[model samples]
Target: MSFAFTSRRLTTLALATAALGLASAAQADNKNLPVASDGTMPSLVVTSTVPGGAFAGHNKRGVALDAEAEFPASRLTAAEQAVFAATFKPKMAPYASAAEALDPESVINSDRRFRVYPQESGYPYRAVGLLTFNQGSGSFSCTAWLISNNTVATAGHCVHSGGSTGVWSTNVVFYPARNGGLSPYGSCTATRLHSVTGWTSSANPEYDYGAARLNCTVGNTTGWLGRAWTTASQVGVPIGIFGYPGDKLSGTQWGGAGAVAVSEARKTRYPIDTAGGQSGAPVVQADGTGPGTCQGDCGIAIHAYAASGGNNSGTRITQAVNNNLQTWINQP
Candidate 1:
């Protein structure tokens, strides 16, 4: 909503991971999905034979056009073909063709890894980005995060823009701060969206942990946060939660303070001092262990966010529980 305390009476929804069509969930260890094509459409898996033959449609981005559209497929020379190939190659893995592999260095390091905790002066891990949404209004906002390989964690509310479909609706975006917070990760379709069974059913904001799956890569980069498991839920632990809060670049960047917090009462609690844009963030414990459950992230309960001491408390939602969410990604 426009304000945090107003408490918008909106119903939260859940999406299974498979709906995203991602390679693997739960660290099933599948590789990253293929990179999207030049066109805005999701990348299609075309065989080498198809590129020069059957491929005949131009995707929305117009970059992944049919080979027939490349002009003369036969009269083209090797050098000419090489130049064309570099322009329209597709695949998420490191390039297989030398033509497309021109900028290997930049492509490889494109995804910047970041740590959430051990808050020193310059922990480059914390990332903050605008969470563009359309929740009944046209205004824009932001969210922050700690990376886990193109994967970021923040609150559900930040991404839930408005209705359920179309542009500027629910399923907001996260743009990791690179290039001085200027460039943005291309908007990915919400392949899968979800939240804990408990939170959506009830009206608890602390347990309001919801996550959305992106079919497109932001920044064409990578970032990942290890999922916290139920096996390790500790209270009174220091954790970090990063996101692009309402503030600006000059102010507290990287979603502000990532001090430690207690993890009592796993669910039905969240005492972090962040506003709306900090939902669904991955909370990391200071010990560097699993249970990376922290506030500003959502979906499954792992550990609540209480004060450093034991005075306060909140819910603990982690990918560990949400990890299984892949099972329900596309039930239909």
Candidate 2:
């Protein structure tokens, strides 16, 4: 299928803001500029075909997590290793706040995360999984979740290296509710990748969110998470992050919940614990309150970075983001 933004491009932000009454006149005006000029950009969509097949062969059912062996060490090339290292730069500190600080006992050895087992047993959890892909000269992994029958939302960095010199990723695959090597709902490969020019061309964290259109309709069986955006402050709102973390057993889903510590125009920060592989995980409302347009189990941000300054952060789902996601979700 050809990849391109839908008819709703230029006026999407305007209409969304007006309908939701979420942003002020100044905020809406600033968001309407072209992305390279430090404003929102149109979504960039790319299409690719899985060379061999779309379905990953590993569909072992009723497999025990403990019985599976650990994944082998990554065989990244020197150049790829350097690129991976750059992602860890603590350029920004966590959002400073008294509530953002956690008690030592509140976190177990500085990690408050817990594993989610029988991943396919329920909503939200079953929709999230490990996202493994090949970029440059190495293979890497991140987290992703379904938003539509064939669309999986993820971090922009997971799909492209970012910036003027970056390249789009290859051999992308999504393993929904994967427990160790057991793919309860099977696996699917990406046929299309979508992000914004702000991220693909400028590597801006404000736009560091992306989505993939799968070759299979696995989300129908797994169910998908609802998404929402608001101009209202998100501080103190209870939220959760669920995804496959590399710090734990391979393919294991670990998650945690905490109050939103900081809310920026394009970012949201929290005291939640997350590791490298958890990037692109959904940051959803934990209080079961579905704000404007949220159907339930609604995601408000795409978890993207580890604790900087103080709290972990992600790309907040703003008006422009919601517009692009709505378009992507309805793509044929």
Candidate 3:
């Protein structure tokens, strides 16, 4: 199958019109739901609030956390909190925090293929970094990569608490090029979030894909990655996985190289080293000749799960995701 990608143009008027269309549809669909402060389509609401004071926590990144770091009680209803509490909580990583551990060679010592991505790493991955938000127990982190001037792609679970719960994530923020607790390109909150209904409803791993629209166009300053689908041959090509693994130094950028071992219907397997915080890291194929190679490197999958055998897997990006991404990109 041919790889599909999102197209960007400089049509201000067209974008404005599309935004209006999305806003109208959102109102008709859920008028009771809150709309974005700018009168645009509101992000998916987490209706239930976490009881008691907001569960206070640290970002692992050394920077001081902000009010956005906590999920306010008014947004999420009590019912939603129960759904979030029921979600699986994987065991916490044992490795001590690798803060300020910029040298990847030292941290991923067990594996020769993995290395730390330096602070000055060039685009398009320079826009990839840790994504943080509030859930049931407390705050959590994942990986997210910029795809457009203001759009970030991450795993579905990071955006929505998929299952019958419909517990959408709240107070989400992105830290681009974060290295050892430092946000080199700064951070921003997600103005709008999008994810597949299959994942939101059934928690399907195959459909574990999501995107967030940032409050500002940070990608233009840091650059963003392109995305595409590929056949077995292209899929097998060596690809780079970038993210902040909880085990490696909380919120520090890490990089590793691995080739796709197999391509399933909607997922790809790789032996990339990753931990809990690495979820949503982009599995990106580097610049080369092929359908998805024209725009330097293109992201093909979203890092989602890992196994004890050292095998890590992600949700394959499909045409449906491409269409959703287009809808998000065109929104005002």
Candidate 4:
């Protein structure tokens, strides 16, 4: 299902920087945590009731610690440039396994320095926000965005703690177009969750992508992004990511735009600035012409991990994953 994108109301300059913590706002609502469904991981589970039942675990926020923020173009030697060019060539076959793939010539986008996102922007920023959930005695936070009216995409580890013994996260909430403590479109609890079995069972980073079905139809109000399975030839194409990062002003929303550094079947690497809470932020490319093109923006991948402090990577929305998202979105 598709909807028109809406502009977020901007707050006064002084109030814009004051960060709002969703966990604290809804902490008292913990008793209302939603009951865990019986369905298995990697499969979509849908619930009708509103989200609630907060647990006792502390809130875990994601953090990005990169000493070298963006890569320097002038510093790239001729040999390094050749390596990057070769590594990003279009592939003839699908990726064998994102879990075992190695990228030796990874680079970072230098367009944006790690910082806060402007309050008012276009569709890309409007579709992104903060996601918080109850884990044990505290709540953990990550970034997430709308791909459809009821579906929000994010990192699998954010939905289910990765590893062999991973368990689903409960009492999840999404705050779209959040600025400071303000939630422009309000917040909704996840009625259902979806992730790949590879991530839930083995904590495979390649399968880190995940999605949530919200009880609220926020898409009708704020609009949503479209999904696309990008190719290696599309590598270096400009993309933008808007999300909530813990290192920034008290978890306020922030964003950065850059090109795809590495494109593979399982994951896509870019220089977009992100941290812990930023996981799950949609890595989107401009879809079509004019304004509101390609249903606001085409979601290329789900931002999940970072390495060497230079490149922030995500689970590329391959054909298989794209099919899964469509299946989940079409579910009743």
Candidate 5:
């Protein structure tokens, strides 16, 4: 409910500035979508997907979206077209609900989590689910990252979907899979799920992120990533990311070896795809050193990169660190 626009509802909006009805490669200026260069930033007209369908919906449990075809556009501007191409694809991942395919009563680390062997030193995290309304039959899931055996961070939108109707709690769970192969499940009930005054009032995706204080350490597991950087996030940094993609399997590493990008939207183009299930993962960056993360990544540390990126293949604060849901989940 963070957005009025869901996969379920998408109505057309009339254009005011048809100045450039459709920007193309020929219009290099339009391609960049200049940010700080201009005194005023250009507002991007997004071609939103219809709500409640399978356009890009990832699967989890039993809730899934079926395959659907897209119509070619003749009314898109340059940026809209680019976003369309960037997001436009065939069969990314399957969508499902949490209980749908899970082996009920399965052990956490054994069946659920795909443990990640960190080559470098940094934090690891993942998302969880909380049963929702409708007689236990129709439930909504929220995303969270395991900070330790007990804490995590997530989007405020994940918790309170505006007002009493969408806000959810109870029976919360966490899954850590820096890799998509295996996933370790952990239980963490929601002790607190609040957002900034600015975030609640404004459905701003950037400000919509939130954090959760878990009741205990994530099953008392050791080697889980610790927390760092407590607020007012800095830009121009390269960030590592992780998440459980509902479309495909979990434990993703889709970008090529060291194909790094910035933490712009908290999402990047990578092969390790997740539709809706990969919500609430962490986007971390290195503190000391170890293994690294790349594009097509989610939920890792957040940082702007160093130049050249040979020894440090990090991303820029420009492309990668924009519109991110910056929150310190389970950061103690």
Candidate 6:
């Protein structure tokens, strides 16, 4: 897919100055922790569950990670599609494509997100999926990605109503690489959902992230993405966001890439085009060089909100978030 980027480049002198400023700040704040190792697991709260116990299969041992996208031999048969359609109703309420509270000018004028054809056959792409859950009387949809053999990371709001009076979502299901009525990898029900207290208590956007432990070890087949946390400024880091968008064809995965425009202590902003269902999409390192601070297919943030001032944003991976993810990924 093609991304629209301005031809402007930062000069060597400017780059040097920025680096020096960052170095000084890091030294002053002692923020130079090792990206992959510094995080300590934080306490997590259960936000939802599947009552009769959803666990069944044992996780595959020594499963190898796929370095590249894989294509399926064939699409689902008509009978299979019919069965899935009858059982899994597509009654998802559209997440707001653009946050109404934000300035309209903050949103990108052009929607550059491109559909991922045969998304179910792609590696990292397939790991990203459509998340549908029951929240009150309605079914709502969001995006999520596999971070472990049996767990997926997503926006906290996708799993919980948020705040002290918030209610946990129920009947959460994940359809990896779902394409319209085509569920190439089938789907898995989340047995247990997780979130942090900051969001569960105050609906804080900074803590607007969560995970769901699946009833199956599908990540062993699709392969999960790695995550990293860094104190360094992520501005200009090339990243891609891929997930199902409510505005596009239902259940279709769309994606786009762009450099981080603004990097704050807990959030990163970019101009990559996205819509409502795209929340919880992985903000992955797009250069293929891996994250400078972590190994493998590393993701740096969880895409959470729409354009605020001039760009869309995600909850940046920080030490606490990283630690919690590491712990969740290891949970049986």
Q: Which window of 10 residues has the lowest lDDT sum in candidate 2?
A: 46-55
User: Which 10 consecutive positions of candidate 6 have the poorest summed lDDT?
Assistant: 1-10
lDDT of 6 at 277: 74
User: In candidate 4, what are the lDDT values of residues 62-90, reduced to their tens digit?
Assistant: 42111111211122345663453333221
- Best candidate per TM-score, number? 6
Residues 1-332 of candidate 1 have per-residue lDDT tens digits of 01010001112232232334222322332221211112122221111101011111112454421111111112234566345333321111111124222221120222222323211322233233334444443434444343322333444333332122312225344444422322322333344444432333332334434444544433223233333334344544445545433222211234332333334333423334443233344454433333442222222232222222222222353322333332222221
Regions of model 1 farther than 4 Å from truth:
1-128, 138-153, 159-171, 178-181, 184-191, 231-233, 249-252, 255-261, 267-273, 286-314, 318-320, 324-332
TM-score of 5: 0.39
Error of 6 at 135 (Å): 0.4
52-169 in candidate 2: lDDT tens per residue? 1111112246643212222311234556545644432211111222432322112223788988974545666878878888777767788898877678888887887777677777
As a whole number from 0 to 100, the lDDT of residue 12 in candidate 1 is 27
Model 3 alpha-carbon drift over 4 Å, by segment: 7-109, 113-118, 231-235, 289-294, 308-310
Against the unseen true structure, what C-alpha lDDT does each candidate score? Answer: 0.31, 0.64, 0.59, 0.56, 0.30, 0.64
* Cα misplacement distance, residue 141 of candidate 6 (Å): 0.6
Pairing residues by index, what is the TM-score of model 3?
Answer: 0.68
Q: Which ranges of candidate 6 are over 4 A from the true structure? A: 1-107, 118-121, 287-291
By the TM-score metric, which is better: model 3 or model 6? 6
Cα lDDT of model 5 by residue, 252-295, tens digit = 42111223332233222211222343344444434432232121
The TM-score of predicted model 2 comes to 0.70
Better of 3 and 6 by lDDT: 6
In candidate 2, which residue pairs clash?
93-308, 93-309, 94-308, 94-309, 94-310, 94-311
Two-way lDDT contest, 4 vs 6, winner? 6
Candidate scoring better on lDDT of 3 and 5: 3
TM-score for each model: 0.45, 0.70, 0.68, 0.65, 0.39, 0.71
Cα error, residue 51 of model 1, in Å, equals 40
